[model samples]
Target: MHQGDPRDGAVTGLQAGDAVDLGRGTALLGCGGGGQVDHMVHALRVALGADTVPVVPLDGPAHSVIAVGLVGSTTVLEEKTPSGRELPDALAAVERWTGRRADAVVAAQIGGVTGPAAALTAHAAGLPLVDADLVGRATPRIDQLSLFVDPLPTVTAAAVTSSGLRIVVDAPDPRDLETVWREAVSHSGGWAAFAIGPVDAELLAGRAVDGSVTRAVRTGRAAGRARDVEHLAAVSGGRLVARGRVLDVQRGGDAVSFVHGSMAIRDAGTGAVVRVEAGSEWVHCLVDGEPVASTPSCIVVVDARSLRPVSTDRARVGDELAVVVLPGAPWWWAEPHRTDRVAPRAFGIDADPVPEPGQRPARGGVR
Candidate 1:
């Protein structure tokens, strides 16, 4: 493990092997969004080389923690690679805009690429990474973050393209910020590196999902030992709700903001069928046309053979998969408005978000 400053003392850094675990953990948490981490893992490995990337506790003495990740359609990102400098450039831009140096960097969400992207940015900037995140998983919009619901001050944001172009926005309204950032991403050839927030440790302590980074690492390690859904469930709050081979996939309307679609997975033995809806992230899932799991609760599809997650873009016909459902972060359950913001209805599904089996009822009864 790479060590940070002696004054910082004993901080655990992510070794090269941890990248694989982090990637798997993030894919599980992505809820079928957050883009794939295959490229990110390669990037991080090359960037960190023989040294471990330092990770600090969120509660550590950092006065300012900036959230950093890629913004825009994951489909576009696959074709347009980042310049390897976009994140650091955006981080520098955020620092200039905020007039405050980033004391640490935190993942915007614990999804496939974003977590590693944040870690890479922190390493590039020579700052410690916080073992926490704004959202426990990926969401389609900027307004979905717990920090947004907390209405944290808009400390300015920077979006940098792979071409080295940069645009900074200072919108106070989260919704407006999303709109502007999306437009900027569209203009930048559909994706860009985004740096937002200077959320203080004090504010993050109260609002950010604590220990999420560590959870991702743990979940990744568990995945390596997973023999079945039961093993996966033991580590993540995930359960195998359905198993089948994909029969068909129908994409929803094309949007610059997200990749939307629906897919049907049919059981080979029983011929039972389940349909999964996606909006950047998987939003709702149904077994035999009856709601089984919906947004606010994570619905994921994993390869039955390898137990590796299958992103919506990659779910093909004849691929055997286990549909798994996991409980959302505590903040989503605690905040009614937050749940409503990402509810099935928000994704054009008519049903309400459903809780995982044996899980406590969502507060306010699932909007």
Candidate 2:
């Protein structure tokens, strides 16, 4: 209900049209991962026949918040459509386990589906959705949450397997939260509806990535008018790193990954080889074998002409593509510890955080 502060910005709420734009925006934010979310967009539209899912202030006057997201194989999710009980069931289970009702629904992370899904959960629970997210960009791991990285006190998590199995965990160590929950997901064939929180508003006061909801909407609008990938990059505050033809697509290295691999792009202008790596999300891009752009920056690959973001799975050899690198949320880069959690090193890639997009030459000494 807190709305007056200028820091919260002007985001009022999300409507049906906003969902379409948000889908595109989140897909871009997904950074060559988070599955194509047209299905989730459609679901949000249908769910919001007329009502606007209320967007509460990020640093609003809420007692506590519960964040929500989906985990598992997106492909399986598309095939076995949800029964509409997953979120409600998961929310209920978490509330019961926590022994307190949530005042707001926060997005655990924003991407193609997670953000919209969290909005849907807010609507179903009759609670407002906070204009914020745990992760500024879609990421592969639960541990990437700002809450864990920033390390606020008293975090609780819960999940409901697709089979309706409920599990709750209160870990002293943040990494164990993912370990315990992911182990439960493995039992459900790697899919579940989840909730995390009762995170007090005081913890979120200055730590949560505020205005993320609005940023997604702005990204969606920018993508809609983009005449080309470069146009989208210019308007969206990202740099078009490479305009190229996809030379190769390598399937995920690990079995549990959503869409992970390295795609080799032959820069059309310079002819230098560029390799973009991923493990559920774009990790970093190498320009002529030199790491140029790496997380926690957002790396995007889009169809060159249509300007639509291309997820890692759909990319194929011979596809014309443009790779863009966007500045990471300032919160991640503000400190060494924060960056350590999201940097390529955190994902086991033996690399350091490179200079931001502007500082380094992209491919062939060209940005």
Candidate 3:
């Protein structure tokens, strides 16, 4: 089983179980969508093996922790398996470019593959794993990090692959950083490992959601008893809005890194059928052609009978999944302030959606 002493001075070695534990925390922080948990868990197991990788808590002095991860589409990652040395190479590139070495590394954001990817990189780079993350939940873009939102300079970044492909980017603006990173990822089979510059641990602690990893463990533990769809939702405090097998998937464009698919579910007792629409992170969940919760709300796809998770990329025709709808980040309902930039409108939806009856808006607004 995965076991570690977070109190250990620094991250050092790890095993398959440890990766599983860490990845579980990432799923909880994902807030619904990130990627497939099984794939991430397997990746962690293969990357970690018997080596003990130390994970450092996201606390303590500033500038001590570094953020490192991957950039590009999960679609690409699924189709192209990395050599597992991509992250270590990326870290070396960043170090060479910035003339700085990382003491500890962190997952840029909490997601299925991202967390483990960061951990694996940290292990290979001989750096501790930092506990904190840039966002409390998984985000669609790298610039959405608190460090970026605060207008902090990305300063330097590196993209690497075991295929001997490597690139370095130095930009003062996060937007510019994202543009360059996207280009590099596109050039490198649409996925590349990255190691970004360090940030103030104090500032990160002030904003990051604490004990996110532990939370994932709790959620996973609760899921142990989820024998049916209803039990699974109760374990997550979520509601099962739809269930079905995938029919078709449409990825509109590069900008829309989401999966657009439809599903049909059958009533357990009556054999009645229902359909639902799906996207990258579950933009809109429907029941027989009616929208239950659109974008900004979390839509999770779990095994219809087993309650396990299914990633967007891996979801396919004839696969049974239970669509769970849950509340979104509470900050989304706030005014048009900078912090409220994650509203549904931000995703290109034309209208603001009203909250379901008895359900409070993320930030307390009616819509």
Task: Kindly give the stretch of ten consecutive residues in candidate 2 with the minimal lDDT sum.
Answer: 358-367
Clashing pairs in 1: none
Tell me how candidate 2 scores on lDDT: 0.79
**How far is 60's C-alpha from truth in model 3 (Å)?**
3.3
Is candidate 1 or 3 superior in TM-score?
A: 1
lDDT of 3 by residue, 1-367 (tens): 4454567423334467666656654564454456545566686688667776665566643365667776777666767766777877777777777776667777776556787777677777777676556654566766666566555545677777534678777788877877887776666677777777755577666545444444454455566667788887787667777666655554443343333444556544434455544444545454554556654455667778766666555566677767776555443433334333444444444335545436555453324
Please give the TM-score that candidate 2 achieves against the real structure: 0.91
Ranking by lDDT: 1, 2, 3
Per-residue accuracy of model 1 over 175-211 as CA lDDT, tens digit each? 8878887777777688888888777788887777777
lDDT assessment of candidate 3? 0.61
lDDT of 2 by residue, 252-290 (tens): 466333345789999998999989988777788999999
Judging by lDDT, tell me the better candidate of 2 and 3. 2
**Predictions in order: lDDT:** 0.79, 0.79, 0.61
**Candidate 2: residue 365 lDDT (0-100):** 19
